[model samples]
Target: MRNAWSRAMVRGAWLLASILGSSAGFCEQMNLREFGQPDGLGNLALNALQQDAQGFLWAGTENGLYRHDGQRIERVATQELRRVAALASGGGHLWILSDTGTWWWHDGRLERVLPRTAKLPQDVPMAIAARGDEAWFVTVGGLQHVVVDRQTDSWSSSPVMTAEQLARHPEMGRLASVMLARDGALWAGCGDAICRWHRGELKRWDARSGVARQQWHALLEASDGSVWARSTQATLQLSAGAEGFVDRTAPSDRGDPMHRYPLVEDAAHRILTASQLGVLRWQGQQWQSFGKRQGLPGDGRVHALLSDREGGLWLGLRGTGLLQWRGYGRWESWTDADGLPSSVVWTMQRDGEGRGALHVGTGRGLAAFDAAQGVFRQVPLPHAGDLFGLVPDGQGGLWAATDVATFHHVRDGRGLPGPITTPGGTEDGFLWALASKDGALWVITAGKLHRWPEAGRGPVQAVPGPPGNAQEHFYDACETPDGTLWLAGARGLARRRAGQWLSSLAVEDGVTYVACGEDGTVVAASEAGQAWRVRTPGAAKPSLESLDAPVLKGRMIVSLLIDSRGWLWLGTDAGLVVHDGTHWKLLDRSQGLAWNDTSGHALYEDGDRSMWIGTSRGLSRLIDPSQVFATALPRPVLMSATR
Candidate 1:
């Protein structure tokens, strides 16, 4: 008993370490929607982006101004205002700045403002900032300001500071970018310094004031009213009432100079920026990058970014057009379009060599996951058949089973010649499941159980199945830690204990799947979605207890898994369901799965504790199960009792 207790403690410690260690570097799943010429944008080089109050996205490209109404993009005809450089929206208007001139769109009217005849800077507009009816433009010549007369439907422009005023305040001249804070303060990026203009007062922070000595290129105000300044070398932020700007640049930014792009804050108050590496989100006092592995399409260099009203981020790439990111979540999927061999995944298992690669068996053939590239590469199989079962051989090799035979020692995309022939020459039958226990392989096929030794010295031996009068069509099998073999099929649930078949639990519908937990707990389910749990599995007198899983009723449960945390996961026809001891949760298409119908024996848990579910349309992964199940516990309530 003491030894058992010690083993339990060791298992608990390992489970805890796995959960904590995996989460430290876990990447949240991202859903991305790409928009390009196929969607009506004339040019893919998006230079500026903005979303209006009505939820319409305005994109400024190198050729013309385009508007996306959540469905399609159409160019807003501008007579000669081409080569759009920047865009801003304020006061029920979207302001467009081009090399030709500046224009504003309001209620379907495009009016050109601050033309060359207006005596504005001839150096070209680099950035624009707007608030209410007023707009500010930063040009190499200086800063320009424009105000609209709503009553008269007109506009006027003037230099923010005259030549004499510039001579007095040289630190605010040669402006590059500008931004208007929530508190009505105007911030601008000067040549080598950042300046703020608030209520007729000017404040400047330069190298002398501890600011990084680089060309300040962009400025932004976060939701919390903190001003962020982006320079050629670093990114700095200045809080309200702070003495000076604090450098918040990531360590990786020191080597890459492309991190000087614009910064935008999401609705959650987290700051995000685009770079050559990918989208970087500022959280926990550091930057977390999301690139192709996180589902960002294209080269990851975003020319412009906008956080929309729906909490979605719009990324404007250089030549790849527009992409809408739904932000990080627990679910992500990959389909055949993402380089998978087939969408119909049958089973998946981790590489026994401990390389962290997942080998997937699909209807077409076998494929291996490429974690670095975020895609799947097909692993050529010697035999041309749909693989239904895949398991690690516990000797740095893999075992795959098809309808006719089972191949062992599959490595480096090659399978050995020797195949354990199916028992009874059942060429017409299908191999349902395979399990490895005590260095031996257990196979279930056509209602019969067979045990094949690892040495491969003799022919396969048939084992006694559970006692049942009905035709037994076995579908799944699992071995408990106590050397008991549990089988599920048309005959219901059965177990082989101490070399003898035990009594089987007969359900109204035949059981199709079974899973064994480390604590000697056994769970079995039927196609009709009825589930039963055995707390004292492998015991002399084991009894089945019905689980109160109403959500699973009427659903086709294709796969079941008892994860290290003791949570029950069910891959069903509708979605992926989980019972975290008490409450039940479902994740489907709305929650980021590619498809609703899951494949049989396609549920897997990797060394990192992340759950992988295979569906008819694609493969889906749940990054961190603990985050989904870490719901707040119910609080105790006091009740008044009547005497």
Candidate 2:
């Protein structure tokens, strides 16, 4: 309650008193601080670094790569002074590779290319491994073999191969990069692929061609010959079944804006980082990037987020607030301080002409905001109401749905008004979910579904179902990509597609809830722990599964949200389950999703990609697809116990 200096004075007095007095002899002082970038690394962003076999630590910096030998700092430059794509260790030297294949470095002198006829592509150079006199370097451009003739102190090229070259090599793609495994098996990230070279034999692995995996990034061969490969997007293990790149933190992530920090996958060291941008391996040397790539939110737990046709971000959050990621790692956030009603916004919908309207859902009522009105004005409705959902009908007249017993707020002469007393069926339970598909308003009632066709429909026709299995009531309803109108019920599942009541799934599948995504992925949760995901048949799926998250094996997942990355965010009773579908990781009291949900409750993804979990302990959030916590948890209001 005091000013900064006053607070400082109080702290100083406490410290002085603790040091001078306290018969208990415990002299302790608390120091609070706002987190910022690492100070020693200074202002320049660090990307990555590698420790060579010797005692030197090579650091990747924004301006240039630096080599430190405990005493002197050596500045590394590209062969042509271009942007250094990355630096790797090979043949007892810190090899500096640029985005361009034109390899160059300073062997205790000015930086210069080692020996390459062309420039590499723009992807950062990942790994460089040396075996005997033969050295291998991987770049976005392609893979190259550099032979260091120690006898002559010179370098020679074996062959320059690109992904396309290897693809056309009459075999698989060229090796992206090569590394010596702990078991002596040579693994190669060939082309957009992976392969093993053993006993003068090259065994190529490509998940796409039924080989193994394509987006191969790095390969790790355990001491027992078990192979682990990290894909371009997910992670995969050989003996454990191949998968994509993975997130193995407290909660695995997929680049959400709600998180304050990001969860970047570090494939090089096989660690998940919470830095700024998502880099691969980090042996404590890399840039400070904050987003889903590392371990935080990409934007903020965006209560509402609008993406422009140009892919720019417009966010709205309750706590840490809003932001817009321009590109790469550049983002901008808007706040009430910057002209807005409040940050507790809810749903956002894209209107005509590529414009987005953000519906700010506060404790009071609903409001709207866009580029035109930087601030929000309460939607003029009949009475005070709490907004539940907002759907933009592509036409000028948008539909705002609320949950105050009376739903529907139509736009009249004023901005938004009127709770159109649409007949909510002759039931008593609340309308838990809403959806509009195939030109019809699909509303889920307590035990049945009501469809109001816009073609002169008065009362919504209630589709009758087998008596309310009182024990089981519908929670949510959806029209799947397969044109099946499905309902998430308690005892069993129900569906009505074409004038036929198809409740066969009830007898077939043991499901309690159903969540179908536009991505043809149908996930249903059972009363038991197993969440059956009936994925549409696809090719090369098993090979792309990542067994990376070592945590989410047995969590009884309840609610499922198919996020922007196409991964599923499973809110469980005991914890939060994150999986690209195949491989899963758990997030609980230890990993952040600390809700006392021994019995699961409501789960939602706010307008922003932030996942909101409503449990017994109130609400928790997962900003970074990996982190689940209560960022904007409501503080309890306690009246005086007595006079």
Index of the highest-lDDT prediction: 1
What Cα-based lDDT does every candidate model obtain? 0.68, 0.42
Residue 127, candidate 2: C-alpha displacement in angstroms: 33
Candidate 2 lDDT, tens digit per residue, 156-265? 66544444545554332344445676445567666666766555456665655344444454455543334555443444445434443333222133433222221222
Model 1 scores a TM of 0.63
TM-scores of the models, in the order given: 0.63, 0.39
Task: Work out how many backbone clashes candidate 1 has.
Answer: 0
Tens-digit per-residue lDDT, 486-600, candidate 1: 8876657777766677777776677777888877778988766788888577666777788888898878777788988888988777878898888898877655666677766
Worst 10 residues of 2 by lDDT: 6-15
Cα misplacement distance, residue 478 of candidate 2 (Å): 1.4
Give candidate 2 regions above 4 Å deviation: 1-346, 353-355, 360-362, 373-377, 383-385, 392-397, 410-414, 422-429, 455-457, 467-472, 507-512, 526-529, 535-559, 563-566, 571-577, 585-643
| TM value for model 2 | 0.39
